[model samples]
Target chain A: MSTSRLARGRAGTSWPRSELPEFSPRELVDEINAGVEQGLRVVAYFGAAEGSDIRLFLVLADDAQSEIAIGTARVEGKAFPSIAEACPQVQLFEREIVEQWELEAIGHPWSKPVRRGRSLLGAAPSASGSSPHLPAVTDFYRVEGAEVHEVGVGPVHASVIEPGHFRFQCHGETVFHLEIALGYQHRGIERALATGPDRRSLHYAETAAGDTTIGHATAYCEVVEALAGARVPARGAVLRGIMLELERLANHVGDLGALAGDVGFLPTASYCGRIRGDYLNLTAELCGSRFGRGFIRPGGCGFDVEATLREQLVERLERAFVDTRSAVELLWGSSSVMERFEATGVVPKQIAKDLGLKGPAARASGLTRDARHDHPSGIYRFHQIPVSSADTGDVFARAYVRWLEIQRSVAFLRDQLATLPDGAVRSTVGPLPEDALAVTLVEGWRGEICHVALTDPQGHFARYKIVDPSFHNWSAVAWTLRGGQISDFPLCNKSFNLSYCGHDL
Target chain B: MLDLFLARLHQKHRTLAFPGGPPPVLPERYRGLPVINEGRCEEGCTACAEACPTEAVLLSPRLGIDLGRCLFCSDCVEACPTDALSFGGDFRQAARNRDDLVVDEERAIRLATALDKKSRRLFGRSLKLRQVSAGGCNGCESDVNVLSTLVWDIGRFGINIVASPRHADGLIITGPVTENMRLALEKTYAAVAPPKIVIAVGACAISGGPFVGHPEAHDGAGSVVPVDLYVPGCPPHPLTILDGLLRLLGRIEEEPGKRAR
Candidate 1:
């Protein structure tokens, strides 16, 4: 069932241009379908335009073998027989490719606009008629029954969030189906990256997902550095690891608080929320920006932890953890919080595996998968964090998994800070090698952030693709809501806290 | 119940004493405005402008920087060999008119032009704003969210972010206003009760920040609606956002006594 022609590689390394086996559009579908049937998950399937033609790249993540298989295909026409019909995981990726390249995935049911904007195959795109850039304006999946009713919320939600639409087909309080309409936050980031790696490109990466700023930025930097064949100093790698873990700590703490707030658990909500800021402030102390925007630059970090700063960070971390432990412990102690969380929004393990769910969401569903553990690079390669998972795929499990991860990340940071390798923070970056493809996977706080960069014959970036953890987990959010009450939607959403722009980009 | 009460008591008030109390401690790395010393620039040097990813810096034009369009990534400052540019602690980066956002050392962004007498009467006491994120990256959205947290507690000043435009006296917007969300932003602006204020927060909303001139983006909030106030930064610090709101309300205390570097 496995394709013998695909080339296998680890994350953060570049493959030669000719190494990946190219197949006809038909062979591509056959290989992906066969691979899925044989239990291999299609981690990322994306398209990059090659002059007048479109080229497809597939990343088949084989968890059992602990290896990632890379393959390629050349499209012959405006449409191809849908592979998504056999493998449900490629459904959104196919939709994205169709919208991006103006190519149709024929016979793929639920074909709709994903990240809708200008078409790449030039004007007069086929899918959305003359103007192909309308978001949340497409045909929605409808349910027909006497009691079936639809509730449409967002693109502009009640809370301060990035814009995205959520349509739920509900039978009274119980939600039968939840269809998410995104692309409202799409700013053409991928299109902008085609001619990047300039000074501006890094800044774009830094804020690609905002909250996952370090995640996306590090992935982008790793790709550039890999292509450039530059190795960051030991101290630099250590600092990157610390910042990454700190970012994870900040977001996890914030999410825990937000989850509590969703259930009206005020003590943990208030305390954790405040502690979240304290963690962010700690990051701010590392770099100037609280969100770590300029912190994770290429080659190394923008800011280094000196002796005094190191002491300050350790002290602040201790204080924040003290508050975090007590605040999060409240969630476990409260019966009301536990009752609201335990069984609400349960996503079975089979659903997670079939859908290719990732990050903490996948871990919560009893899948012991983490990029830091499976595909280690930099500091993670030297010092590994144990994978945390739970058997019950529910709101409680998701929250519980996050708490477990937060503790590990905090401990990881304390250890890293205590024994920071002494060396120069910044290293000189070399030029990129000609005709290379770099695929990097960073275990961002959300889950896995995969960035692929294909360089032209001249070593300049020709095509760049980013697969945020949110891209894989957004469908998981829909899966969790299948039998959940409509009122629990907010709780379910907070448990995931997926990024709209991360997926939209 | 006793444990919950004790949990609350142990966590004494965490809010900062900002608009009234002593100014909170800003980190050494916390960037605000660019302090441009034009005289310090090397001869015939466009290095800063060349290094600026967003073209926020212009040398021939009196070394001006349009903070509205600035990512504030500090690449320009870092690239300056002569120490001509350094980030200053002036967190007051709100402007009234679009042109007021462009600053040299001379044109520093201070307080936004106070609202007209009528707006001061209507919303000066208690202002309710509806925030719309057209195509924000969520950095600015999250920072703005922090204002509602116990640390900021912006509600203490009678300034609250309302859920609906109908209940709002103004609209606070983030993002570069992507084409996909242009319709939503316009509709939201039209929905707010009249004599409404529009405050454009972050580099994206002011001038598309990192995404300027992209075909997918409409540039900034001004492209669709008339923006009354523009808060600048990639995502302006929460204090800067608070200072903008307070300034618009004419509640800004005459520049705090001593400025800490």
Candidate 2:
């Protein structure tokens, strides 16, 4: 892995292909073994490319993390050994690939269909109507018992959060296994991006996930910038960073409040909600809209922050920080709240890493991976904010990690404001390169947001694939649910808080 | 137990006296009701009609605003650019009849100027607000949250958002009034014992916003209801929102305040 040729070239180049070692299907496991021995952690396995009808899987190794083009492209027509036998992490991706791309993973036991009837690419049943739809990966978890009935919760919940169905097979209060079925809220955001829209394409991107407008927009801009070979100005980068941090802080505060409310801590919930509201108001003050909408454009921020307004925001944030700290401390001191969160829904560090969880979720599990720190983009490099990490991967640890993140974000904001430079806020980002393939990875509040953009010859988007942090972390949710009591579901769910719409999109 | 008692004392009584005294009014930029620029329309310019996304602005060749379809998006004012199309400062646009809702250009301009003069007479004020979500996408509701946040700090300006309409001096409504939420909106309004102001926050609440005339939808806050103030925009900027709120409190002066540094 250390000697791997992980070079990224501009638009069109085949030179790097010659530098890398090539392997057939039978040698795939051997190659993976070599990489693992050399300290490569496989991040994800993206299914085959559509229309190519070729069996291909993308392997994102640890060493290649810094490299923009990290994933290995494996063609299925060639002989390749299934890594599922060795790496259990590859099992989930392999299952998805089986249903989506219809590629068989040899030696993989849990290769059942995941989406069943909703799968567009899976093989359909014959006219005999013996089987109405193809079986999915969810069917494998069917429990057999006298009174072990399955309780299905949501494609739509009572809350404002997006849709996700959780099939809890429980005997009384204790849960046996929890199976999650998502994709109800998919609005074809990626597909929409593939087909170009005029100027309003970013508007569609903004709505990919309602709560994550800033994160999605920042990632989207990064992809377009990489593709167009455009460099955002220093000031613009700082502004973008501020906006991103603000979004992260607000969401974290709100989640903490909601988690507290779920555990019946009303005072903490109200206080946190009020504090979160304050942050949102600050966002509205800086930008014209709350939720930080329309703040990030292609080349820069939509508006510049005036000095007077910046000072006002700083004062407001100072008050908010004090209030938030008090509220959090109060909640932490409450024995009831602590009892509910302490050891509930623990995700071991090893399991977290193998699953490639990012953001606060991974950080809480002692994985020192932060896109802001590791893959420094925008003003992150300049600010030098310490990446918050904790060893306990429980609900309390996750909440604590977020609290620490809020402090860091406030400090980062002050630092950025102190060194705020004067320059043009925007530059004209011309059309994207035709043959270029660019990938952008950003540390959103939830986790990592990765966007891969490919353009047509006419400078229009040919394919744009957005992998939100939720996509990688949702599998961890099911794992977190295992062995946990039914009462702890909401707490566990809040600990991860993966976006349903984001994953669906 | 001692700490709990102390904590209870530390909690500020989150209640403000309103209506009995002067109501809390927001700042100048708060988006509230559609203030017709009778002066601008008096010149026979139909810029608002042309600029409206949902044709919420109805300016016939002779008459000015058909308040029935008018969404207070401020597009008319933005289109004027001449500073003639000014907000009327009166947010009570609700009416019992469609005819009463109609604003002739000349009458609207006169009313706006008169309201502006009256607001100038009172310098210090406050307003009690009750917010209702008719059929909003929740975007406007989020913005309303910002009003009380550290940045805008609408509370500092004496504007307090009350939980119940009975304790309110004005109604700050957001949404296009979806069919499901119609009853909720009406009930909320009915709960507010009158002399209460109704401030429609977004284009949706005013003229159904983007949801106006949506073939796939039925029911609008305006269709089943009446509005006093119409602040316009998809989600109007918080400043504009503040301005509309202030007008309801009679806090806004005849002229804009000196721009703060």
For candidate 1, lDDT tens digit of each residue in B1-261? 677777777778888877667768889888888888999987899999999888899776689888888888889888889998888877778878888888897776655857877888898878998989988898999989888889888888788888888989989999998888888888889999798999999999998888999888888999999999999988899988988888888777447522211
Say which candidate scores most in DockQ: 1
- Candidate 2 local lDDT, residue A260: 92
iRMSD (Å) of candidate 1?
Answer: 2.2
TM-scores of chain A across candidates: 0.97, 0.88
Docking class of 1: medium
- Candidate 1's displacement at residue B103, Å, is 1.6
The window of 10 residues in a row where model 1 chain B has the poorest summed lDDT is B252-261
Candidate 2: residue A69 Cα off by (Å)? 4.0
Q: How well does candidate 1 match the true structure in TM-score terms?
A: 0.97
Off by over 4 Å in 2: A1-65, A71-140, B1-261
How would the docking of model 2 be graded? incorrect
How much of the true contact map at the interface does candidate 1 reproduce, as a fraction?
0.80
**Candidate 1 runs further than 4 Å off:** A1-3, A122-133, B257-261
True lDDT of residue A309, candidate 1: 92
